[model samples]
Target: MLIGVLLVISWLILLIRYPTKALPISMAALAGLALVASWVLWEENRDARYLAHLELRLSYDPQQCPGDRPLAVRLKNGSDAALLELRWEVAAYRPGNATNLAQRLYESPRYSGPGELLPGASWNDCLPLPDLRSGYRPSTLEFRAERLQGQFIR
Candidate 1:
């Protein structure tokens, strides 16, 4: 559908440029449309491949780890296939606090490893949490899992 529209527009431009020429307009239209259609197909295939390669599941033991102790996070592969180069982070936040205190414990970006996870497999890592102010409590911990962009291919 998009290819047909682009081909029509391309032919209109060609007609405007060579009004007096008796050249084959259909050939020009087909060539232009083929190039655009090929590009669109290639892009769609690449995106599908990328989505299929992503298969990381993240969870925690307590859901909300205490600020006074080390935090444990579990990373699992939810897909039937294995995932390569899995990386994750555990972000602990104090409830209703406007400031970002998790940075004080774990660095801005934490490194896991270059390992493979089979179907229904998981890995656990313990990260120390930053001490809170007197009487302060944490609301929740957020875990994010993903393949370091462009670091590995499935």
Candidate 2:
């Protein structure tokens, strides 16, 4: 930040002293600034960009485990990377209810499965549901990926 302020000050001084000479220098600095801004933006949104290539589907079987109905999830990797770890937070909601039945709701626990998903591959597993009130049941489950880690495959 200090360096940027100093550069701006020097550039302004040059512009006041030699207007014609400062024109080319100002143009070069503007181009460099644009390049740096673009790189920084890409770095900040890298995770979201890669996550766009992933898809998730949810299915639930109420008869699978008595009071606790584990969710059957299907994750498809559409990117050119191998996924190392993946986890999601689930929200359980009953029909006509405007709120979640999960015990923690916003602070609910995350569920994960064995992850080694390669490009163009799919993984299927049953993830245990978050803690809910005993004997409480939800008609639907919502999943949102909270942890996604992957590497580009060469």
Candidate 3:
């Protein structure tokens, strides 16, 4: 980024001092290339989070969720960096870590904030559950995709 800015500034200075058309064009091209390279590098590295920073909670309340909506989740941002995007899933798992999923929301619901999912900010919403029984037993095996509300690590 600094290099790109410097290139642009140099181009501006050259345009002021030297009135040659080819010189200005060459400097402008170099500046544009620098800008593009910096943007590409940022895109490739910015989303690679160094550590896990997503917090999720599942809830099922008859009063809070009427009708077919029996599952919901609250997502909290607990990272130092703003969450630019999220690839989230909701699943059910047994004690052995076998699992099933109910609903999945990907990068479509883009955060309106500009890379600013500040710490402690949370989002809560109801989820659609399908083919899950309320009377599930602990002793028996069951599929869990429907009642699950979140996946790990974005």
Residue 33, candidate 1: Cα error in Å is 15
Candidate 2: TM-score? 0.55
| Total backbone collisions for each predicted model | 0, 0, 3
C-alpha lDDT score of every prediction, in listed order: 0.53, 0.68, 0.52
- Which candidate number would show the highest lDDT if scored against the true structure? 2
Q: Which parts of model 2 are misplaced by more than 4 Å?
A: 1-40, 62-69, 95-98, 105-109, 133-135, 140-154
Q: Sort every candidate by TM-score, greatest first.
A: 2, 3, 1
- Give the TM-score of each candidate: 0.40, 0.55, 0.42
Candidate 2: lDDT of 126? Answer: 66
Write down the TM-score for model 3. Answer: 0.42
Positional deviation of 91 in candidate 3, in angstroms? 1.3
Worst 10 residues of 2 by lDDT: 145-154
Choose 1 or 3, whichever is better by lDDT.
1
Residue by residue across 29-109, what tens digits does model 1's lDDT show? Answer: 679999999999986675455435554433344445554334555555555555566444434444455554444343344
C-alpha lDDT of residue 11 in model 1? 72
| Candidate 3: count of backbone clashes, pairs at least 3 residues apart or interchain | 3
Model 2 pairs whose backbones collide: none
Off by over 4 Å in 1: 1-69, 95-100, 104-109, 130-154
Q: Which candidate has the highest TM-score of all? A: 2
